[model samples]
Target chain A: MGMTFTSNVLKDGLSRIQREIDAAFDAQLPVPDDMSASLVEAMRYAAIGGGKRVRPLLVASVAELHNGSREQAVRAGCAIEAIHVYSLIHDDLPCMDDDDLRHGKPTLHKKYDDAIAVLAGDSLHALAFDLLASPEMSNDPAVRAELVHALASASGHKGMAGGQVMDIAAEEAGGDLDLHTITRLQQLKTGALLGAAVEMGAIIGRVPSEGRSHLRNYARDIGLAFQIADDLLDVEGDEEAAGKALRKDDAAGKQTFVTLMGAEQARAQASALADQAIGHLSAYGSEADILRELARFIVERDR
Target chain B: MGMTFTSNVLKDGLSRIQREIDAAFDAQLPVPDDMSASLVEAMRYAAIGGGKRVRPLLVASVAELHNGSREQAVRAGCAIEAIHVYSLIHDDLPCMDDDDLRHGKPTLHKKYDDAIAVLAGDSLHALAFDLLASPEMSNDPAVRAELVHALASASGHKGMAGGQVMDIAAEEAGGDLDLHTITRLQQLKTGALLGAAVEMGAIIGRVPSEGRSHLRNYARDIGLAFQIADDLLDVEGDEEAAGKALRKDDAAGKQTFVTLMGAEQARAQASALADQAIGHLSAYGSEADILRELARFIVERDR
Candidate 1:
């Protein structure tokens, strides 16, 4: 019952990716022997503080599904994670989201000063590309180049940056957004990088163009689904479990999927999206079962 | 005597890049009737504001040298310039350099609030990558990928970020820095993108590896030389001529080549580095002479 199918392999892959991510983060700033001890320790504390390595795990799982090397995928996964953390640091700034709780502890900006948090975020963003361009991916410069391009596109404008601008504009504009507007907002704000995560793994794995499209579609669904679940979690999630203050969106008067669609429809939409995402796997035979399950796990997870 | 031989051709190339950059900045925005007018305007202001267009010109020049289409190189050059502007915006933030002036005008933060400046900087950064990954480069995914990778590496840590970190650390520590440390910092801070500009051009043009290496060396030397001259400008430069505050580095107690090496030595070093940079053009024969002139101009210019 436990070990019959290859689905069990995903757990191992996740763990390996977790280990690799930790190693990579640790390796990111190797305590410049001459630098201030306090600064180094603060950087380490900010980086090592816990979060579910969901994004990197997504990359590893997708890479394995493509019959690509998990090792390479994990490296890219870590790079994405680094970028995510960097963004989190910046988002939590006094000028930005200004959150105190992160990963069940004080956020980087809360723990450190706003300046340190800003620098840390900036450094981490830079490091993400450094990790991608490193010798680890040297075997195929083209793939490495693709990874960088995809991540940058997703991380920068027309993706995350655009989404951020939208978020800022929406917050300032102070009106109920149409459903289409909300969808477009979330797609750019969150879906861009999540979609890129899947697309990047496929690109690095050398998946065919059509396969790349399928994976991208799958990622788009799950990316939005992930955000929707996040919105739902914000309304109903436990502070301790979610590792941050819940109901932030409600407090901010932000219009979210849960707010617009209502909880029941949102849940239904999440389920529908998960099903459609899993259906994309039909092209890969049974090898994509884990990706299917992973989608379910994303929408279903309490955290 | 004023226009000189080949200056006309180089000016034409620069003019084309400027127009394309203006169009790219205007056209590539997210299409909706009502976008953030202020943000868009800020982006346009930051990007379209008159500058030397040195980086893009380098890209176009290097592309032509390699028999690559100047159109392709122009795209890459515009993207790099966007990144450069983003850096300038961020660097001028209150938490960073706290500058009031840039390029003879009020800095972004000076003109707007700190928050908008930060957002503008972030947006420009993202837009740069978006431009790089645009359909023009997308036709050859591999080339597009390489362009992304090159810009990311130079812009991110181990390049610009590393230099910034060193700058902050050095400023905070405030010790007599060794020649090696100063060189390392400037190389990362300024030289990285300068190097990236030339390399990005070569990559877009599909120059051979040897040719790319030569251009990189050329860029590396000029980049450092450019910074050395900047240091000199900060020291001995007049307010009217420099178009910004003069001797601010000394006033702020920041370390600079002029402060460490003295004005005369800094100028001498710049001249030597400029000559070395021009020497890399031996490969280009006559084609690279404009680049050589550009390097000389960088060091010689009062502004």
Candidate 2:
């Protein structure tokens, strides 16, 4: 791989997606001049002007590889990002992780009251499906339905929320979990949405299920690699650079890849998984360069 | 109206929908014997064997009026009911209503913990969209997409959740709201979902937006009447029969219909609204009898 080219593509792609994601949210969540104004303001505070936009980048890149429209993919990406943002808001509530900071600022619950935070999170949750089911998502009703199904399945009890349940349970168990259990938990917690991002892109491209095996494999590999990288970052990264609390896993005594496998081995594993993820896209040419570079960046970036 | 005949239809319809809604939840939320077991258990606990199933009943009754398939309507009803139930669960959280009892039992957060309660509520919210987007909801993808769209729009910030924000603000405002403002607040908080229930049924029955004026009117009237009746219940009805806290509006110093208008006037207003709601269904004679009786039952019910 050409290091400079990969760096440029990854950096430019990240910046472009960050802009688009913010713009999409700005367009969707206009605060009404009413009692709900603060709620929408909280949603805007949480959604816009922050985050890495990694999920949206994945959705756009995968969609590009499959020749999907940029506009539709961006819309779908916003839907996915809404789910991610809402989860974070709720996770930061006093009853949950009890964090006071997110994205280098006061968390939604801290900025607003707990009730506003809860309702804002919920409003965003509903907004995800609303965006997906809208006519703007796709001209074909089947496509919109498929997108809603993919997202809803990834978000519900059997997926992201369920993973959260396992996470809380694992914490209660004093982090005495095996590697397999931790892997499953992360897959449910973070991997499900990552996988859905890719799957929704395929659906947008009208790619059949059987034809998406390589993409699915690519998503699966990167999902695990992403979690391992996150674990490593939590252990070694700076809070200022990460823009959120670091060392939380260590402080909470939660089982993570770095704890279970050690930093050195975990780093190696993440690299190998990223390599495997790129390998899954071997059939595609330069059109998939962004995705390939994204895989590499997943393990290489500081945050 | 024939008194006995209307009463029988209303009784049978409510019971049937109650059974169907419970059965649908039972079939959907099968707990996995894993770390997430408690999460799913909390979901099942919050979802099944509770509530009046009024939303689902509205969906079924409206769908029946349009001659839509019973099974499909029941499925859509379940989707709406899921949204309703999730809202109730979140509304009962410590940061929100701070209620201990719901449906004559401990609230989910009280029974389990706040984390479980939050995730369970979120899971069910996603499940509502998942169920609507599923093939089982409708043979036509267009219908499925429309159902998701309807439910999502109704439940989001501009609708039910937005209404909740206003409700909270009203409480903070020391119950000084006028009748118009309170009416608008109640419309969004409760009327949106009720209106969506009827609208979704119309969509399932293949009624276009232009042809839905009468049904929409009926829904709007009943929605307000339902809230007014609820206020009456809060003031005068027994907690044992109502299955939850009562007189919360007075306790919190929140403005409600009963506070803005005297009890006698509010009762008369609800009764008049119910009559007008039934009047909107005049075009459909015996076919909409259940709906008509339902309008009557809305103001007349003790709990």
Top of the candidates by DockQ: 2
User: What TM-score would every model get versus the actual structure?
Assistant: 0.87, 0.98
Chain A of candidate 2 gets a TM-score of 0.97
Clashes of 1: 1
Expressed as tens digits, the lDDT of each residue in B73-107 for candidate 1 is 77787788888888888788777777888778888
lDDT string, candidate 2, B9-45, tens digits: 8889999999999999999989898899999999999
Instruction: Give RMSD (Å) of candidate 2 vs. truth.
Output: 1.4
Question: In angstroms, how far off is A11's CA in candidate 1?
Answer: 5.1
Compute the lDDT for candidate 2: 0.91
Across residues A156-218, which tens digit of lDDT does each residue of candidate 2 receive? Answer: 999999999999999888768999999999999989999999999998888898999999999
Clashing residue pairs for model 1: A157-B126
lDDT of 1 by residue, A1-303 (tens): 123223565566556667778887787667765433334455667776485677887777777766788778877887888778877777776677878988888888678666566666766676677677655765776676667777877876566766777787777665668778878878988898888788767866678767577788898899889888888898888888888878888778888888889998998898789888887777886667667777887787777
RMSD of 1: 3.9
Worst 10 residues of 1 chain A by lDDT: A1-10
How is the predicted docking of candidate 1 categorized under the CAPRI scheme? acceptable
